[model samples]
Target: MTTTTAFTIAADGSYAARLAGEGDALYAERWTLAGPEAYAVPLPLAQPEEADSEVLPLADGRVLIHRRVAERHAFALLYPTGAETGPSTGELQLGGVEVREGVRVRLLPPCPAGTGAFALAAEDTVTTVWQVTGDPSGPRPVARIPGRCSGGVWLDRAGRLLALDRELEGITKAVAVDLASAGVSPLLQITEDSDDRLLLADPDSGLLLIRSDAPGTARLGWGVLGSSLPVRFPECLARTGEARPFAVQPGQSLMPETCGVALRLPEGDIGLWRPADRQVFRLAAPTGWLGGSGLWSAQGRLHLPYATPEVSCGMVGLDLPVSPPPPVVLESPTPTAPRPVPLQQAPLAGR
Candidate 1:
């Protein structure tokens, strides 16, 4: 039985997969179409802090890892330790800094340029957007959008910002803010009274995906720009009456080329669906206790970390083939022999 824990793919199509034994440390290995081989490289992140680390691939071909440094609730961004031996040590910067006591820092996704921008949900119930420019040592506030912001997405291409504002009356509305003029407008109003839910806006496709509770199950609903009602994707609905969607891939929009739904199942299996064909394929599964999973690179490969059945703990790399071949079998060879030679020779000798 083979088990894979974590996986990442380089630009050149080579893959790095990590596996762990029953012990404390994690084992990382590299592989290619040639063959699978193990490398004596340091694990991406260290021991106890491994559970909280998040890995994101940058536009510059480098990987950004966000690790929690200490119990004081501080995070440090570092490059992978075994990344091609280019840089010995990566620069560490503090994120979600405590501006005031008891203020928790929930770091949002950075922009595409890796400019170190994040959202801060303050203890006073105010949400502000902060930008860190130049060096990692200097971080400054760029702009602040008013109205208790819970979740937001940067519309870089459209030059707009979509944020969710939670009202005091327990109503949430999707607002669109113009970055240039700093004006805010209500785009969609969610009257479901679900403050714990999240709203996502895909800038590329200009679509919104909402997580809300349905009649008998928790489900995800998709909405286009001009549509009054959302078209629900039944596959994303939960089966056990649980309203939690485990793993959800952000809606990716490559103009004129839209891919379908990609999410993880409750059983720890990753699946990708193409809406046009209504097809679904399994990407990976948990061989042990999977810590976390996400897309490793922009090329559409997934990275997952879990306790390996063979080793202590490890990671697995899962890549969906461009076009997987159908199952086939190879025929075996048949033996040939000189049949009646012995019988003919005995008859001649007797004659």
Candidate 2:
């Protein structure tokens, strides 16, 4: 099995990952998401500087990749060749298009209406909407967001682009863009200095989940389209004393799938809240200093990037079961064993 450098889980719960170890060799691996691993198909790009690649699974089973070559970036559509061999080779459906100049592509939403491709964010600062056509090499731009955009989502069932714009006045406003018409319109305008982060939207319900810090603490709020006032979840409270919200995620495994919000407390503890049932879970002080932390993945996974006495820098993954009421702090079932490094004998000692 090849060593994986980075990986992401597909919407279908399968895994599409890239591996690169010594010698800068690159290989793409696809596997099942379920625990017990299965066969893997490896494709070799085989380049010294082949770093930073994104694998986006298409609705039709083909995977779209944005790989960096030389100093430029290109898009490739990869699929099974139906032959059993090394480096599952496939045709290059596209090449030589700059998705976002200077910055790597961050997120790629699924294609919609067979008319538009997807939108890509550069360093989470600049956003550009790309139209993926049958001719892969000819992906054209639909719209370019002017400033830094965050909390992006494809709102409608048709996947219309929706995002929160962080304005110059330090205000975050909800904005929507029509991909077909290239029309940008402001959906909700927030005046408070609180960090108004967009969570998720249910097209069927027209209910937009948002996290806002107004009461000197982060709180869960929900509102529908054309509505300026948001109904705040009175039960959910921020454990963090900083009056800021760090992360907000919608419960996936729950019966109805409620919203879970995490707050970074000043004392370094993390407070998790479920807005639907008004339940709170608290994780004690992190194992180490809390440089930063968040709900890192779409799945129920929390990643804390911190420094330890032994390890200068590392990310610890907390394995907690996903249920109606998720656990706040995860306890490792087995203790991590330490490896000792042998010291070399001194020349003076030998003499």
Candidate 3:
């Protein structure tokens, strides 16, 4: 069966996802949401194995695709040609960092404000962070944190702050890294025993979705950023299908209560998550199709991609309502909120 892999959507609503193509070769397909259409990008010529390659959509409707040669990672910018042949090559740039055998390298997404600033991480013993500013040069090395590093999600659109989970002294802790100062600070908490696993956070929304063991279960946890008082996502999280969040819409980023995640249901449906009210909206898909997370457009439309049992796939453009429809009028089951999880009591005096 043709399985879907990692997917990413551009700011301009272009969608890209990896999937099985002609024969046994894996290829990345680009989608133009307007037509709800999909097509495969050109496969690499030099190293057709597609080793360590990735396709990331750019703001200008093109794609920055990685093509590896001799274990070195290189990139090519592809321009859409709207034909079944393939995307035409536009520009090429070699990655600055060398590929270490076991070390993992990642190209972080740019800030959501379309700031053209992003980060590249080279992970080994110590985490080396590089700030890429679209300069003619390349990614400029910035912070190097000790121990292991992960969960590298941007916290601010300014590219001034980032949130990552790390092990410092053998204890796992989630902390924020200041892009400007390279200083790391531990995120505060609502209780003493709270072990926060920072998932994805939005500074503008002041809303952070995390995983914690507070309620004796490692379920979704959420709270305002600086408030530091994260609460368990209410025992009645009222969700399934393991949704992946999409980009926040413009002008609505600062709204603390709003957010969205594209979920894949077991019965082959696209589930939309607005956790503020524990809402899940399921949109049915064609039979035998599986869908992935999507991108939120400025026009309040969601562009999602789906994979079929065959090599080809499809895209869907979902229009979000400007105003909430009365719950009683809707067909989707209403999400119910249970009583909030009880907070842990403070430690008495001292041990």
Q: What is the C-alpha RMSD of each candidate to the true structure, in Å?
A: 20.2, 15.7, 7.4
* Cand. 3 Cα-lDDT: 0.54
- Model 3: which ten-residue window has the lowest total lDDT? 330-339
lDDT of 2 at 263: 55
Output the better candidate (2/3) by TM-score: 3
Q: What are the runs in model 2 whose C-alpha is more than 4 Å off? A: 1-6, 11-23, 33-40, 69-71, 84-87, 99-104, 110-117, 121-127, 133-137, 164-170, 192-195, 217-237, 240-274, 281-351
Report lDDT (Cα) of residue 251, candidate 2: 32
TM-score of model 1 relative to the true fold? 0.56
lDDT of 3 by residue, 209-309 (tens): 66665555455555655442335464324355344444444434444455554445556666655545445667875444433456666555666566665
In order of appearance, the predictions have TM-scores of 0.56, 0.59, 0.71
- Give the alpha carbon lDDT tens digit for every residue of 1-351 in model 2: 223344433433333333434455665544333344333455554443255676555545456677666555667666667556643557465654554456645445443332334545544454666665464446677777665666565555555554544443456655676766776766543433445556655333244556655434456554443333334544444333343345444233221134444556666677655444444566764565333334334454655444345643334555333446543321111122211111111112221
Ranking by TM-score: 3, 2, 1
True lDDT of residue 262, candidate 3:
48
TM-score of 2: 0.59
Judging by TM-score against the true structure, name the best candidate: 3
How badly does each model clash, as a count of residue pairs?
A: 19, 1, 0
